[model samples]
Every structure is written in C-alpha cells, then in structure tokens.
Target: MEQAVCCYRHQDRETGVRCSRCERPICPECMVSASVGFQCPECVGQARPERQAQRPRTMTGGAVAANPRLITMILIGINVAVFLAVQAVGDSLVQDLILYGAWPPVDPTSGVAEGQWYRLLTATFLHQNVMHIGFNMLSLWWIGPGLEVALGRVRFLAVYLLSALGGSALSFLLANPNAGSLGASGAVFGLLGATFVLMRRLRYDSRPIVAIIVLNLFFTFAQTGTIDWRAHIGGLVTGAVVAFGMVHAPRERRALVQWGTCVAVAVVIVALVVVGTYRINH
Candidate 1:
C-alpha cells in the first residue's frame, strides 16, 4: 500500500485509518467500523467478503439478519389484512376461500375435488372472527421470529407454508367432505414443532416447549367436534421432520438434506391432496 497524504474520499481531511477490506486511507467521516478495524462506506455497503473466516452465520447455517422479526411481522400483517377482508366481504369470500374437501357433497360441484386445489393453502390465511385470528397470530409471533433467525428467511418461510399445506392436506383427507375449516393454527403448530426441534438440537431444556405442545394438543382434541385436529397434527409432524433436517444435517451435505426434506414434505402434501380428491369424487 502506498502512503497517502490525505483521505481517499476527501483530499482536505487527513487520516491514519485504513479500510480493512480495501486498505484505502479513510477519514473519520468516511470510515465505518468493521469487525477488524475500519471499512470505507462503499466497501461496508457491499456484501460480506467471501472469506469464510470473516463470514457470520446463524446456528443452522443461515445468514445472520439485522432484523430477525421482519418475516414474522409481515406474516402477521398479511393475516390481519386477510381477516379484515373477510369481515368486509362477508360469507361469499369465506365460501370461495375456505378449505373444503368437497362442498354440497352429493352434488360435488366445488372444492379440492372440483379442481380448486389452492384452497389447501389459501384457507390457512382466511380467518372468520377476531378471536380466531388473534390467538393464531399471537402464537405465530411468539414462535416465528426466533426460528426465522435460526433457519434464515427462505428456509423459515418454507417451514411455515409447507406446514400449512400439510395441515390442509390432512384436513382434506380426514374431515367431512362437506365441512369447511380455516385458520393458521396448523402453521402456528408447525412453528412450535420446529422450535421444539431446535431446542432439542441445542441440548437446551425441552420441558417448556413440551408442556406447551401438550397443552395445545389437549385444547385441540377437546374441541374436536368443532375443530379439525388433523390439520394441527399434520403440521406438527411435518414441522418436526423439517426442523430435524434443518438442525441435524451434516454441515458438509447440509443444503442437500435440508432442501430434500422440504421437497419430500411437499410431495407428501401433494399426494394427500390427490388421494383425498379422488376419494371425495368417487
């Protein structure tokens, strides 16, 4: 490095500090603090250098986030917005969006059986009342952010949507063909399941999450006539499997196992939906 008389960015301002990345002379105003010494504004704004030793990662191989709660907040916002839409639009929106294996079972004119397969996932977002949305969103907030931080954004989102899909798939298979169900309970349970898996992975005390799960499962079964326990159970099992892969896969082949778990779960969801649809129609 050549000795310079003044800062690279400002010839008038002299400085002794050099950017750790680019090794350029920088003044106090232009220099940004870095893990090592200092970095110029441009270098600081760029993505972290590919050097493995300097790269920061979350426990399960996710890039550390500046705001871990961003995804959770977005999910909550979406749920609130959808709930408001349901309130304003009335029963028609509910009819169109609610998850059903088949509607008017004798006629079999609509539902997953009638090629409206999107209901499997969309129904998870449709909430009919304040209490329903309130509890589910609260559960999501409590469980989602930490998992998002640990698993990274894309992987965390995969767990959520897939869990929801798993729930819808099971409900479609097991619930009455004419019956309708909607809620984020499946995804919430999924997040809870994933959280428990991570706690076990880290060898932390697992009793708290276990207790929570047992309590929720009891609540689910207690209301079985009105509630679809299948969705909750499906999401729970799927999330646990996914999180196990996320936290336990060998570091050398981590990406393969993690994504393979997601793909495999997705295949199962698709299969369940197909079989359910076939049975409903026949």
Candidate 2:
C-alpha cells in the first residue's frame, strides 16, 4: 500500500502519509496542512525566493547549518579516535607527532629540524593520557560549538588551525627542545579566546569567559611541569586576533580583511618558527 512506501521527497524517511492532491508518499517536512489530509510540498508551490529567504545565516555571514555542533563533534571524535589509537599502537605515536625543536644538538633524526614540519599540525591531535584527552575534549565541547556558530565552519576551521599552528610555533620557540608536548589544548584555548572576542562583538557579557581564562592561566602556571603554557597562551592570543578581524571588518570589505588577517597571522607564525629554529640550532 501507499502507507508502506517511503516518502517521495525524502527517500530515507518512511511514512504512511500521502499528499491529498498528488497522492504521493510524503514525509512530515514535505507535508502541508490542507483541507483534507495533507498536500505535498510540490502541490503547495512554495516560491523559490521565499525558501531562500527562510534559509538561516550565521552572525559572521556564513550559512547556518542544521547541526551547529557538527564540526565541534567531529573534532572531539578525531581527538578521541587518536587517543584510542595511541592506547593500541603504543606511546611511540606521541613522539612521532609531537611538536618539538631540533634534536641531538647536531644530528637530528626527527622533529621539525629534520623537515618533519607536519608535526606542527599533527601534534595538535595527539593525546596519550586519558585525563589529558578527556579535559581537552571537554573544553572543546564547551567552547567550540558557539564559536563555530558565530564564525561559521570555514572561518571557524581557519581560526582553529591557525591557533593550533600558533600554539605549536610558540611552544617550539620557547619550550625545551627535548620537552615536547601534544594535545588539543591549543585549539580549545583558541576557542576560548574566540568566544571572548565574539561576546564582545555581539555586545554580550564577556565576564564568564574571562573568569574561565583567568582560572586556566592560574592552573597553567601552577602546573608548569605538566602543562604546555606556551601553547595555551599562543592559541589564546592567536584566536583573539583572528576573531577580532572576523567580527569587526566592514561589511563591504569583510572577506578581504578577515582572510587577510588569517594570512597575516600565518606569516607571523611561520616567522616565529623560523626564528625559533634558527636560535635553537645556533
């Protein structure tokens, strides 16, 4: 019977309802309230411009997605997957992916010095300890979605990656060459910083994020032996700068300024890495 078939508009959706006029199977979303049963979307004849007008939009000029948290969830999943893989493959994975300066004082087999520059980005995803991954993922879940919503996926992703790179670059510049680090802490801190900037842009109360940042900073200093404070501070600073351009750029020239800001930040990050490496090797 018609009731046993799938919806014509949404094949994946099984439904018993059929359009009164078209007599086609219809899902709830495609069904329009009518005099009798329900009319299919096609029968109602919604205008193209009307549908377009109904589309959602992000605050920063990106299209609002149905699932606002999708990117955040994906990031968390990747972090968790990497954590589990580490548990299975062994601790060596951490060394392979972690951000570190030159090694052996002369003969470097691994690290950024030996042309393993991918570590700058890869290190952001590696996590060995359960507590470490747990905390970072929690922070990401808490901070990422809202920023993602405000900035939209592409800009949000740009900020995240730049923040990660910024964190890695600074860590390599200052932290012990041998004392490398790994985790999503940098990206999460970026989101925190972006959140603070966005709150200011939207004229929302910014005190909450500030309080959280202050608390995290205190812990960073208190646990200097464990926490990579350089990455945290670097990500925070980078995220804020990137987000400042995102929310403040003029309407007519927004795209140019926003992307220009990212490119400029990236150049600065590269310069930091180069200068830091030169100092380390010298």
Candidate 3:
C-alpha cells in the first residue's frame, strides 16, 4: 500500500538504505561504510574532520601510540640483546664482530679480509662495555621515537643501517688497520643529523641541534682514546645526506626519491670499502 522511497541523490533509483547519522535516504552508490552503518555523502563530509582530529597525528598509517615507534624499539631490543649475549659469551664476540679496516693489517683470524664484510654493519650492534651500550641506547631512546614517527618505519631504518655502513667504511679508511671498533654510536649520531636536517627543512630554528652536534664533536675528538671520531663524522654526514633528500623530495615522487637515495648511499659506502681495501692491499 505504501510507495517505496527513492534515494535523495538518485531520485530515479529506489533504496531502503538510510544514513546512520542523519537518517537520510541513500542509494547503494551513495553509501559510505561506517562503524555502525552506511552514511550518506553529506554526513561523511561533515564527520570527516572530526574523525581525523580524533586520530593521533602520525606521518604514516601507524601511530606512535599504537606502535610506539615499533622499529626504534626493535632496534634497541636487538642492541640490548646483543650486549647481553656479548657479556655472557665474553670478549670473543667483540673480537669477531668489531669493525677492523684493512689498512691496519689485522690478523687473518680477525676476519676483516677473509670476505666477512658484514662487519661494516654488524659492528654497530656490538659495544665495548655496559657504559657504551647504556649511553648509546639512551641516546637512541631520546631521539628514536620522534625520528621514527617523522620518517616512518622503513625510511628511518634505511637511514640507520646506511649510516652504520658509512661509519664503518669511514672508520676503515681513517683508523689504523688493526684498530677495532664497535657500538651504535654511528647510528645514534645519524639520528641526530637527521633531526637537524628535518628541522631545518621545516623552517624551524636549528641552533639547538647545531649546539648539540658541536658538543658531540667536541667530545669525539676531545676524548682520550678509542673514540672512533671518524665513524661519528661519517655517520653524521651520511645521515644528513639521506635526510636532505627525504625532506626535499617532491610529494608526487617521494617514495621513489627516498628509495633511490638509499640505494645511492649503499653504493657509495660499498665503493668506499672497495677503494679502501684496494689501497691497503696494494
């Protein structure tokens, strides 16, 4: 006896769906799925801003609260776990995993030249003592969450690993061949450099960052021994390079540019290692 209702947006089409929020007639084509029920376009448009405002501010889909800097936490966990394993195993782990550049002519057993090049990156996970791991982890904790949120998980990881690689390569080139080094200081310095670059890109005052960097550099060279100043400098510069591209990349081609920059950084580090090895071998 009663006539069927037609959608407000499509008068010719009949529908039974109604917007959950406003209780307006809507066709299937005009429906937008919501938690409770379908919504009309008008309701969706009006509710969008409020929904977005309620959501946490994040550079990527994962929020800091939901994931809590998942990548950063994982890295810290790995470092701490490695540190504990080293303590349990004794100094042998340090002897094997520490970065040893070719120039210093380390013992063959040390594995610098027997094609175990992974030390370039692996050394970053090693630490000399409790103080070393403690300080590095502290610095990572201080900077990691903010940087991870800013760069997103993947890009943040790329910067860290590449900076570690750069640190070892430069340490190899500059340090005595037999000089061995280990720690996440390179990666930690990388975060500092990235933060500095991002702040500058966002047109924010970077003097405090500059001041912190200056203090670190002062401590690096100012230290008495085994400081691996070269590694710190290398990581800082490499991180800045990566961050520069990430910050300046065009929104339309951001992923492509960021990924390409990572590849280029890896290539550069590999090239440095090859050249350094060759010069030392000859």
Give TM-scores for every candidate, taking all chains together and pairing residue i with residue i. 0.83, 0.80, 0.80
Off by over 4 Å in 2: 1-54, 102-110
Better of 1 and 3 by lDDT: 1
Using lDDT as the measure, which candidate wins? 1
The clash count of every prediction, one per candidate, is 0, 0, 3
> lDDT (CA) for every model shown?
0.86, 0.84, 0.83
lDDT by residue (67-173, candidate 1, tens digit) is 99989999999999988988888889888888875422344544677788888888999886888899999899889998999999888998999999999898888
**Residue 41, model 1: Cα distance from true site in angstroms:** 9.7
Model 3 lDDT, full chain set? 0.83
lDDT string for model 2 (3-102, tens) is 4689997899999889888799999898889878899877778545677777876777777887889988888888888888888888788878878654
As a whole number from 0 to 100, the lDDT of residue 222 in candidate 2 is: 98
Q: Candidate 1: which stretches are off by over 4 Å?
A: 1-54, 102-110
Q: How much is 149 displaced in model 3, in angstroms?
A: 0.7
| Residue pairs that clash (backbone atoms under 3 angstroms), model 3 | 103-177, 104-177, 104-178
Candidate 3 versus the native: TM-score?
0.80
* By lDDT: ranked, best first: 1, 2, 3
